[model samples]
Structure formats: C-alpha cells, structure tokens
Target: MEQYKGRAIVQKIAAGRIWFYTKEEQSVKRYRVEDTEKEWKRYEAARDEAVRELNGLREKAVRELGEINAAIFEAHALMLEDRDYSDSVKNIIETQGVNAEYAVAATGDNFARMFSGMEDEYFRAKAADVQDISERVIGILSGRRKRKKMGKEPVIVVAEDLAPSETVQMDKSKVLGFVTRQGSSQSHTAILARTMNLPALIGVPVREEWDGKMAVLDGVNGLLYVDPDEETLENMRKLQKEEQERIRLLTEYKDQETVTKSGRRVRLCANVGSVSDVAGALQNGAEGIGLFRSEYLFLEADHCPTEEEQFQTYRLAVEMMAGKPVVIRTIDIGADKRAPYMEGEPFHLEQETNPAMGLRGIRLSLEKEELFKTQLRAILRAGAYGEVSILYPLITSVEEFKRAKALLKEVEEELADFGIPCGKVRQGVMIETPAAAVLSDLLAAEAEFFSIGTNDLSQYTMAVDRENPRTEEYFDSHHPALLRLIEYTVKNARAAGIPVGICGDLGSDESLTEFFVKVGVDELSVPPSRVLPLREKIRNID
Candidate 1:
C-alpha cells in the first residue's frame, strides 16, 4: 500500500476500502450481413435499457443529491433519445454491418473527440458524458453489466475517471467518496461530488493493482493515505472533526451581515457572469452583484451582440437583483477571453504575440468605440430597471477611462434621441494594473467607484501569468507589494469619496479577510458559493 496525492474537489474526509469499477469491452465480430434491421433492433433494445437505468438513477439522485444535480441523469436520458447520438449509432450499425456494441463504441469515440477539440473547458468535459452513456449501451449489448446490488457498507470508489452519467447512477449510499486518476476541479465529477457533499480527489496517479485496500481519503488537503498507521488515522479524525465544525459554524452566517468587530460594514457581493448565476448567488445570501461580467455575452456569441440582445440580458439581471446595486462591467475582450469575430480588420487582436499584455479590456473598447457604445446603451437601458452601475475593465490610465466615458455619453445622447428612457448610471473603473493602482487617485476623481481586480494586478505587478500553472509559484497574490498596491488604491479611492471593492479569486481568501477589513475595503465580490463563507470570515474578523 502506498500514499497518493491529487487535487481536491470537495473538502471532506473519509476512510473506506477501495472499490474498483472496471468497464470491460467485448470484441464484436464485424462482417457484411443483410441483417441490418436485426442490428437496429439490438441497438434500440440496449438504448432503451440504458435509459431505464438512467431514469432510476435520476430518481435516486433527486432524493439524495437534489434536482439540479439529478439533472445530469435527465440529460443522459435525453441523449439516449437524441437523434444525433442514437441515429449515428444506428447508421454505423446498418452501413458498416457491425454489432450494436461495436457501433456505439465507435460512435461514442467520434462524438467525444468533437467535444474534446473545443476551446471551452465546460464543453470539453461534456465529452466524458457522451462516452459514459455510450459505454452503457455497449455494456448491455456485449452482455456485461455492473453489479445489480451494492456492498453492505459504503466504500471509496477508485476509477480512472467518473463521468456525469456514471456519477449519478452510482449507489450514493454505498459510495463513501471518490478517487480518480483523471479530472479537473471543474469536471462534472467534481461538481457532482460537491453537490453530494462527498469527499473526492482527482488527478491521482493510476495504480492497476490496488483493490480492496483500506485508505483514508483526505479531501481537504488532497492526500490519500493507503494502509495508514494508527497515528495517521487518529490525526485525520481530529482534522475531519474540525472541518465539520467549521462548516457548521459557517452555516450560522448564511443570512448575517459582514460587519467587522469595529462595527464597520462591508458589502458582501457575488461576481456573476450571467442571469443563470443570479438565482444561486441570491440563494447563497449575496447582498448584490458587485461585478456582472458582461464580457460573457460577447464572448459566447458568434459575432457582436446586438443592442437589444445585450439590453434584454442586462435588463433580466437588473430586474432579478431588484433594488440591489448591480455593477455591470463593460464588454472586456481579448487575452484569454477573446471575441473571435473581431479577429481581423478593425480589431486584429488574434495576431498578438502576447495577448495577455496586448490590446485588451478598456484598450480594445477604446479602439472600437462602436462596440463600447452598444454595450453602454444596453447597460444604461438596464439601469432604468434597477441600480445598475457601469465599470470599465483593464483601466490603466485616466485617458482610457475618459475616452470610454465620452463614448458612453455619446451612447446616452443617441438613446435619448431615439426616445429611449434611461436612468442615471454611475460609472466606475477597474484598477487591475499596477499603473491603475498607482493612478487610482486620478481615476477615482473621475470614476464613481473602484473594483480592484487582484487577479490581473498580481499578474501584472509580478509579471507572472496566474493562469499558467508553471508561474503559480511566482504568482503570489499575498505578496507585500501586491497588498501595498491594494492598500494604496483603497486609500486613494477613499480620498476621492468613492467606494472601493476587490473582485477576484482572492476576495474570498480567509487569510486576507482581516487585512481587507483593516484596509477600509468597502466590498468583496467573489463567486456565488463564497458569499456566505466570506461573510462568515469577515463577520468573525475586525
């Protein structure tokens, strides 16, 4: 027995015997036969059986994991009925004169490859789902299947990977946790593990000969202790209890305000990307939308979003937020987040050798004034429904903010000319660059508010790309230099009588909660799930 390490998806702890699930594929004989109809019937029967099993799993998931998580099975059910997937299997069986098992196995690989080729990480993970469902059909057709009954006690599931379908279908009661060799923090397996509140570790090294081994899976620190000594087990028990107690304590602050011991109030808000996230954020007790990433609308579209398209999206968000202030960031493109449609002609950002430092954010908008104005018009129209404040991202200079503001004014004049009723929208700037932090006083004088984008500032100040894992050692957000920049920006923003906030991954870092509260930070905008935990941290700190 040996210890293994991996990335933790859900923070929890469990000690159980390993239960290895293996999918053994059968070699189906392929030949030219006139029995195409027979092969079709065989494929249909296997598909129907798979769907029936999936529906049963969906029901169990709803009972144990809740409806949102159970939807993964529903999607699997739909995929079985979807013509694109089903028809492809049928076509391959009929045309190639192969058995249902071989047809599905071949078709699944082809379809999964398509998703794996895509840029978006979300869609890339969906490829696993496609393959998982196909494997079910193959399993039935090849006369191989999972055990109909589970063991008496729950066991730790060790696998190469667990797709959404496989994850939802597993007997949750008999599965204490999961240990996988391949998966990311954002994989569907991770998401489901979080939903089920199960301890899970991914990216563990593959071990072909470790079945029935007793292992203490520590999800909090992402370590797996195989055949641990009594002392190790005792230590892990204490840590697990502490973690459970911490979670219980955090639940008490789900609806509490993030006021420091000094009685200074700090706004706890969520950085949402779309309207879909608004409901979850509110459920997690988000006071308001501190950063509405408006770039997703542009990034997801095939071309530039039309004024009405952008208007409706923004309006839905504002209306959903009700009276809460929603700081909508302007359409920030280029860099990692690129609008492929603007690759040529007026915007040749695709050719940038270093897009990370090239024309992006406010700089890109200033170059394409029309694109910036279209978004401004939509944001202003949305402002009519609620407290919608505009924030320009990647503002390194006062001149960039000034020019963007002028275009916004031009959009307002045009909207007014067209008999459109708009509300007064407060303009703000994102201090994401070292230069911006240095010029915060000048920017805050003109801007109504400031949201510090620590992700960018740390990268720029340290000249290390936070996205690159290789540079993670050097990409320290807690660097004294970075903190000083944040402290200075907060002071400058306060001097100009403007509210200052931090909107980045670091916003939820508990270690920095006291520091942020000390520096007179007005708000902290983090992911929806962090709203309550961060609030608890702030409320406990002065």
Candidate 2:
C-alpha cells in the first residue's frame, strides 16, 4: 500500500469509510477507504441499539403524547422495521452472504434505490446510514472483527462536504486539520471545526484516487500541500508554529473590552441560535448577545416549546451573559421555517411566489397568537434574571404592531394575575421589509426600538431574491435603495427617540460602518471577529 504521511481531521464514520484531503496536483482531493473490521463492528452494534431505541420511541409516541405528529414518528419506525430492508440481510445470511461484506454492500445498494426518490435529505442520508448499519449487522452475523481507523500518523480529512454530525465524530488527537473539496467557511462543518479549535480549509478540489494518503492542511491561510518534499514539510511546521503564536496573542485581547483608540465603545455581541452557542460567544469576548435568534427553541423541539420551557432557555441565556442585554428576536418562523404545530397548510403545498411578503416573520406570528404568546411569556419570566428585550420580526403594518403589543399587554396582565412580577422587557421591531421601512416612523412610535435586518431589507428594497444565483449581482447590500431604506429607518428611530441598531451581516461590514454611523444608527452589532476590526475602523474614522 502507498503511504503518504500528513495531517487530516476525521469528518465522518460510516461503512468503514475514512475520507481525508491531500494536495497532490495544486488542488485538494478527498480520499476514502474501508476502515478496519473491528471499528466497523462497533459502529454496527451502536446502530442496532439506536434502531431498537428508535423503534421503541415510535411505539411510545403512539401510546403517549409527543411534540411532533405520531404519524411522522411512526414513519421512522416503519423505516427501521421495513420488511425489504431486514429481508435483504436475512436472504444474504441464509446463503452464507457469499462474502458477508459483499452481501451487505448489495443490501446498501437495494436500500439506496428504495429511498433515492424520497424528498427529505435527512431520510436520504439515512439510507446511507442504513447501508452502514446493514454492513455492520452482516459483519456481526459473520463474526468479523477489526480495528478502528485511528492512525498514529497525522492526517487531514478532505471531503466534498462534511455534515455537522460527521464533523463531531472526528478524533481530535489524530486530526491535524481539515480540508474540504467543496464548502464555504460559513458552512456548519467549518464553524464546528473552528469551535473545536481545529484547523479547517474548504473549497478544495478532490478525487477518488486520493484515498489512503497524507496531506498538509493549513486552515489559517487556506493552503493544502499533499505529499510534499522534506523542505516544504519543514517550512509548513515553521509556519504552523508562527500561526499558533499569533493566535495566542489574539487570545490575550479577547477578554478586553473592544474599545477604539478614539474612545468609541461599541457593544461586541454574539449572534446566536442555540443555548450551546453561549460558550462560543463568551469565549469570543462578546459584551452581550446582540441577536439571540430564538428559532431553535421552536424548531429543534418536536412541538412548540411551552412557556416554562421557553422561560428556562431565556433564563439560561441570561445567566450565561451575566445580565448583559440579550435582544431575543421572537420566533422567526415563516414559510421557509414551517412548524407543524403552527397554523398553515404544508408550506410546500401552497408556497407563495413571493414568500418574502407572504406569511413570514411577524405576519405568521400574529396568525399563531398562541405560539407568539408562549415566546413572550418566556422572555418576560426570564427578564427577572437579566436584561432581555423582545425584537419583533418582519413587521409590515402599524396594525400588526398594535395587535402584537396588545397581546403583550394581555400576557403581562396574565402574569400579574398569577402574582408573578414580569420584568421590564422592552419591545422592538425588525426593519426588514420595504413596507416596514416606509412606515418606520409610525411603527417606531409604537415600538421601543428598531433593529435593521439588512438582509431582508436589501432583498425587499432591491426587489431581488438573494437565493437566485442569476440575480445575485443585483442583491447588493450597498444598493442605493437599500441604503436609503436604512437611512430612513435610522432617521425614523432617531425621530421617535428610540435606540436603533443594525443587526444584519452589513452591521459588521467595515465599508458600511462609516455610512451607518453617518446615517446615525445608535448601535452596530456584528459577528465576534468583526467586532475589533470594525471598532478599529470606526476609531480611525474622523
């Protein structure tokens, strides 16, 4: 066997496949192969256990109440209990499975065909899992034992893409870095790798022949060297040492307040979606969580999170932030983020051509008062722990603001009736749509604050779908119309005497910081990395 020694991160564990990246021809390549038999068997046992547990879950879901639909839960059960799936293995075992490995490989192919046409990506990926699981089951049936894929030599995992679940399975000690054939730095795999303090490089090219090789991965500078000469290897080691030192220097500054030389202090807050992300924000020296996208509480849970559950989540975030201002955006669910518990036919069945203007953001929240109320109560109850503010999203009309505020009032009254002292939770609206911007003056009068969601504002103002690659060119945040809308919202907020903040990707943009300052936004909240740079830029601005 040819051995190319280098660095790699373990991205996935399935069907004895160990994928890694190496730069052989001025490009990265994804290599994969069969892991040892023992590792394969261990994973197989785990799968069987999971399958059994999942089946039990399905049965219990029917007998008891679940957050998600019982029917949906049962579908997973049916998949596990599929006759065709189990029978394929049974048939293979009856014939001594030829080679048990070969028989399991055949079963994988069969399951893939059966699930290939399914619409869900999760289920489709499950087919691959089935293949892995079946391979293990067959191995167990045939009594094959082997070792795990951890090697003493360092390796850099390279793949076309790595899922979050796959990324978490990495053996950190053996993984030097990760280089992917296709991925953006903002993707989940990259983010997870960064959080884990591992080197990760994406957007590399790959091929099948790269299997069982070594490659030097430089995630800091996005460089990958495959099968390099002695000189190149030595140089890389030196560069790695320098990079580590630079990171160490940066770490010392992380805990310090992000103050500019000119004495302009901007709140460097983290934008988070989950409670687990609290540590990342604090580690990055976030003054507070500027935008806590609370959708995970609703979306991750099978059913709508109860008022108490929502309260606990907010409480945890508040505790984590140590009373820093946490701008909790109300459940930002929409046609794009459909909830089974919410009112609305299947989103796909009656999708609007103009979903941006359709049932989304605050519009959908109003339709589902129960869902909205549950979130509001949670925020209010949690307010006792720390500074929590409610940010309403996708508000298009003055009436919608009035109605939502009235509901808030109702919630406050209900809390009072129970002798619970609801904390002072300020209310605000996201200036996202064109209508919201145009009517910002009126909405600002009713709302406590304004946060310009530039992503949607740019889309609505420019009349461009950001998702469409063909029209991506027109989807600039710097478009004159978008700038004007931002100017308008900031102006309106100033007039209403309410604090206004920019919370979108544009907020952190150094190029736009000056313009946003000129437009007179009270605050600018960006990602953790941009905090210092943007602060520096603003400090330099006269």
In model 1, what lDDT does residue 67 have?
Answer: 71
Give candidate 2 regions above 4 Å deviation.
Answer: 1-247, 250-265, 335-354
Compared with the true structure, what per-residue lDDT tens digits does model 1 show for residues 269-305?
A: 9887667678877877888999887876665443345
Clashing pairs in 2: 7-155, 7-156, 8-155, 8-156, 8-157, 9-157, 20-158, 21-158, 37-146, 38-146
lDDT of 2 by residue, 1-542 (tens): 22232222222211112345322121111222233344335434644654665567567756753434344445444554677765664465445424334545567667765654578744543554454445444444444423234577555566666544345435554665566665443344544453345666555565556656555655434456555567766766787677657555566566665555656555566667667667777876677877887875665544345576678778889998997889999977654454332321111114578755677777767876766787888889898888989988888899988998899999999999999967888989989889999999999889898988887777777877643434655566678888888898889898989988888778866788778776677777665554544555666666
For candidate 2, report its TM-score. 0.63
Task: Point out where model 1 deviates above 4 Å.
Answer: 1-4, 7-219, 223-249, 339-348
Q: Give all TM-scores, in the order shown.
A: 0.62, 0.63
Task: Report every candidate's CA lDDT.
Answer: 0.79, 0.64
Using TM-score as the measure, which candidate wins? 2
Q: Residue pairs in steric clash, candidate 1?
A: none
* Clash totals, every prediction: 0, 10
Where does candidate 1 have its weakest 10-residue lDDT segment?
A: 339-348
lDDT value, residue 409 of candidate 1: 88
